[model samples]
Target: MTACIDTLDTPAAVVDVTRMQRNIQRMQAQADRLGVRLRPHVKTSKCAAVVEAQIAAGAQGITVSTLKEAQAFFQQGITDILYAVAMAPGKLTQALALRRAGCGLAIITDSVAGAKAITEFGRAQSESFEVFIEIDSDHHRSGVRSDDPVLVEIARILHTGGAVLKGVMTHAGESYSLNTLEALQAIAELERSECVKAAEAIRAAGLPCPEVSVGSTPTALSAVRLEGVTELRAGVYVFFDLVMHNVGVCRLDELALSVLTTVIGHQAEKGWIITDSGWMAMSRDRGTQSQASDYGYGLVCNSAGELIEGLQLRSANQEHGVASFEKGQNVDIEQRFPIGTRLRVLPNHACATGAQYSAYEALDERGEARQWPRHNGW
Candidate 1:
């Protein structure tokens, strides 16, 4: 018999098919409205089914955080893959293998050393590896500053050393910390301008910089215009978690992913409901901690995925989740959430939570579910 969330084992990763499709369409529409290609970051779901849905919605290519994702997706017939992280010298062979195998796999780097390493390896193997210079648009993570001369130098290294200098890319990851629309727009613009500036700088230096990419979920959704950007890349937006909601990029109802668990026990005197899902399942992401509202590990929800206001997974152990009513709710907890009571918990970081599972129990609107496998490691 086909399984549903209710019939699945506890601590399973569940994706609401309806909500997920909505999210996919929303992001694709946003990209269309902005007149840019959407290269979705597959690192969020790391599942073939999820990535296929994104491509079906008009996404051009995919951005990946690890070469493992590149390899996995490539095996699935996805050729246009961008390895968004800085290229590690040791992984050049693996990257080369993908390219030689007909994968249009692009790699990125931010430092002179990384650039030289990629160029040297490409030259040695007679492979003009496609490369993008990482731009530090928000000073949030990896990338060279748009104004920094190193930007031009890195481009030169790739071009002169027989590598394809594809363009420049930046991720305004810090946008996650902002909740206001104004702040989000400002950072989005900053992300756009800086990344464009980098691309322009490389072109000005007589380099063929064709693509300019920038985004983060909040920034992508907030940006009013992307005048010079060629493409936008975002990950967590696929299955937004509490963090994206707190960032004002998505509504709580838009979160397509959740961890399905069961009330295994209870601490009636303390008003705590013990569950089978712990840090292992939900991940250690307390992403909403510094936001306006802290959602301990995650917010509590009924089995149907409806939010249970004022309740959160307050604490967790290796195998147990301690859920409690946010102070002063003097209700009979034992009678409310007795043993064997099934529940779903929304995650703070969808990517992290999804990593804890190898496959998702894709729950459809009709309540039927099927397994969609996802890859992990490195």
Candidate 2:
């Protein structure tokens, strides 16, 4: 008998268990081959069950974008954690609380002011916080430059103020814009060299620089080597999406995360199928628009997860999505996707789409489904 997953409520987030596990193992193997420990970013799933599977597959620790993730995962008994975002002074209390509760959380800083904040807070609390210097490898986002004179200055500030210098980290966030292996590999190499250079400079300044970390799903998979990096972090690879597919890292068959939406109605004249999933269900992130291939809201597929050629979520409302053929109108749209027909839409950004739902319906090889709870918000 076919699985009852199709009977679930419309607009639910679904995970193909086999594909999810395969994705996890593929990343673990790549990290092993590169000689760097895999510290997957939990912001992708924010579910303890998912992180547990990553750990079982040989992930050394988990990375987070917010303190809430650090706390939630810590409560589930995950001790090793790296808060990848640059630390904000106002949140030091929250970080301190997690640390005092024995979370083993490491924070990051990219400026002298940020370093001073950490030092002052640690001093007031009479504890030396473990911290990493954010290095900008591709000039993508927040981070001090690899060769900037301020790199050593920030390190000296953290060291002089009683914070343990944990080394450097850089993410080739710009790699997401590249589609060629050569471009991806070049950014990966730049990510490695820049971070290593920062760590070496800090160490040459008579400081303790033990870890050199860098990653992004594209770079992590594209890197031909990881000679000086000690650890790696990549999220979204756990649940490949349209954006990653367009970036040439994963294939359509590997997109494990999708929205299980039911065909509610159709506009026959316009050849559009109205689904219950809207921006509220799939998120408003159009990350694929700027990619090599724009998937509109998402790529539509049958209930069995097979792609439906030309089907695209062309438009959406708060609680509705208009799916239509990209190139031509379906003459019998209603008959093709009759009312209550089940379908799935591969999301543009797995992280954004996953946040729209509180729990995921995980479908296993037996065609059975179960719920996996996830934490959200700040």
Candidate 3:
């Protein structure tokens, strides 16, 4: 049977196809304008259809956080893949298996021990794995500091120890904390300069450093120049959530992913509209809490994917989401949203929300929904 969103089950993951395609084009255009290849991080959608659309829109390759994603996409005929996370010793066997099967799976590391492990594993397996040294551009997460002497030491380890040292890459994840253009741009420049500095240090030490990759959705959209960067990488821009909206990179209307839920009941006296979607359905991500606007669990939208202003998911239990207005606002919840009313909730974090579901009901312009399966787990 041909399915429509109106007939689908509640608490389902839904994607607005048109908006998603537009998002893909926007990010691809940003990469083009900066004169760098867009290696979109697939950790956002983790769906083949979405990745295929990204590649069709001029993305050169893909970035993944896990070898499972690498294997999944590689089986879909994508050969060029970068496992962007710092490599753990336990996962080397799976990474090697992928490379041996003809997948151009490049792994990364930020420590001397990690570098030695990769090189030793490569030598034992008679393989030269492509490797990138992760740089901690924003000091928000893992990576060697761009100025740290260990930067060159790690690079030299890979180059002289049998691994193909691809280059340097960094993610300015701290960009998520800013909302203004000035701050975003400043962090973007910082991200670019710091990553490039690390690459220069490597080359100054007489090592071959070809690629300088840097990005995060906010930084990628705000970067004014990529003078030393050969590639850009970003993940969550594809299904922008409330977090990205509050970060000022995307508008409320551009959000492509939402949770389709049903208004199962109401608390008229308390003026609350209860829904079937809870943290279990939305994955408990309160990413918008520190932003300029805090949508409790999420912002409430109509089933058609339009925000119903003044309303948000105020609280959530395991399977119950309570929707109410901002403090001081008064509205008749029962009359406005009665039993069996189908509604949508825009999440605070797209990646976390997406991880809750196994597949997406992609809604096209004509109101038809088709299933697009996504993978979960490590």
Query: Would you list the C-alpha lDDT of every candidate in the order shown?
Result: 0.93, 0.92, 0.93
Worst ten-residue run, lDDT, model 1? 325-334
Better of 2 and 3 by TM-score: 3
lDDT score, candidate 3: 0.93
lDDT tens digits, residues 1-378, model 1? 989877899899999999999999998999999999999999999999999999999999999988889999999999999999999999999999999999999999999999999999988999999999999998897899999998898899999999999999999989988989999999999999999988889889899999999988889899899999999999998899999998888899999999999999987888889999999989998999899988999988999999998889999898899999978988788898889999899999999999999999999999999999988997
Best by lDDT: 3
Model 3 CA deviation exceeding 4 Å by range = none
Taking the tens digit of each residue's C-alpha lDDT, what string does model 3 give over 94-114?
Answer: 998998899999999999999
lDDT of 1 at 236: 90
lDDT tens digits, residue span 1-378, model 2: 434576777888999989999999999999999989999998999998899999999999889998989999999999899999899999999999988999899999999999999999899999899999999988888999988999999999999999999989989899999999999999999999999999999999998999998999999999999998999999999999999999999999999998999998998877889999899999999998897788899999999899998898988899999999965544578878999999899999999999998998888988787888998988
Model 1: colliding residue pairs: none
Model 2: how far is 138 from its true place, Å? 0.8
